[model samples]
Target: MHKSIAIIYNQPAASPYRDRNEQSAEDGVLVEVAAVEKALHFLGYLTSKIPLALPLEQAFSELSLITADIVFNLFEGFSGFPETEALIVEQLEALKLRYTGSPAAALKLALDKAETKTVLKQEGILTPAFQLLDNATLSDFKLNFPCIVKPNAEDASHSLNVKSVVYDYDALKDMVSEISGMYGKKALVEEYIDGREFNMTIMGNNILTTLPISEICFSLPQDT
Candidate 1:
């Protein structure tokens, strides 16, 4: 007997981007979904592709109707509404369905960068000193010059661009206000750490396995 898989992913919509020329990260998920579905089919598993959209109740109803043994869990939530990503996972839990990827708790924690930083600090991990600005008021700004500002709750580099890095207080204030006005979220200001960045992908639950590490080589300016 073959195992059935439900490849659930977000149906992307037009969203605001700091760089208009940059492709929509939300829409990019479709390409990933297609690849995963193809691989599953090639491996002889019965796969069903379900694209979810806005209105959480409708998405939940659609999920509730799934009969697959497991879900691929590619849903990243609707554009301009990143909070729905974890909410969808919570619904999956309520349905008592096994799904791939991180749990709702982890998703919620990761979405809030400030909270994640706090957790890291508690765990004795060394992270850069940072502050969250809910508005344009920048009294007692302590972060050094050449700091970077970004939307507090966004992922996929939504409001991040070349201009995200600031070298002065005026530019920092402007950037913070830009994030608040455009994304309607608090701004996170952190001291700029100029150095190499790498990403490590880990898999599994009880016994984790780390994949090959990849380094991000920057060809852009230092402040970018």
Candidate 2:
């Protein structure tokens, strides 16, 4: 059976690197979409490519088009919305269409760093001390200084940068305000780990395996 696939990626407004020309304009997301499209075309999948400014509806109802088979989930975000990842999956499930990548709950859990940390902490895992914010109170309790501030509900380093490190109360307050205003979400401030850095990647549930652990290499005059 032939299938229609939608290769979606992060949109501009939701991207923190929207203005970052580290490589080129357009944030290079189109490059990703194009790569995936080309790869599938190389394969034997009768795929139809589509750009998503909306959710799963993007796969259908565009110039009178609708997909009847599998939908290769490539959507990173929709219409500059940061939390739209799971939303797309949900729409797919509602349509009873098979796609790829993490399920909706995983997307929700991974996107919410605070919840993920709590689950980890409850499981006796180590995590940095953190705080959540809202319109009312934001860190009334003591939070470790020289901390890192990240959006409570955003990813892709939205407003996160090396400058996200703040050492004083006023700086923290300003950062929180800016983040809340810009992303319609709270900020999480956690103690900065000054010693070392590392990363771990896990693929497939109930079938866990570590390929190669990543390490941070501190160069002279960089870590200091």
> lDDT by residue for model 2 over 129-188, one digit each (tens)?
998764457648477788888788766556666668889988888777776776677777
Q: Give the worst 10-residue stretch by lDDT in candidate 2.
A: 17-26
In candidate 2, which residue pairs clash?
none
Q: What do the candidate models score in CA lDDT, each in turn? A: 0.87, 0.69
TM-score of 2: 0.76
- Model 2 stretches with alpha carbons more than 4 Å out: 1-26, 55-69, 134-139, 195-199, 205-224
> Which number leads on lDDT?
1
**Candidate 1 C-alpha lDDT tens digits along 112-213:** 999999999999999999998856457868877889999889888777788999999889888988887777777899988889999998989999999999
**Pairs with steric clashes in candidate 1:** none
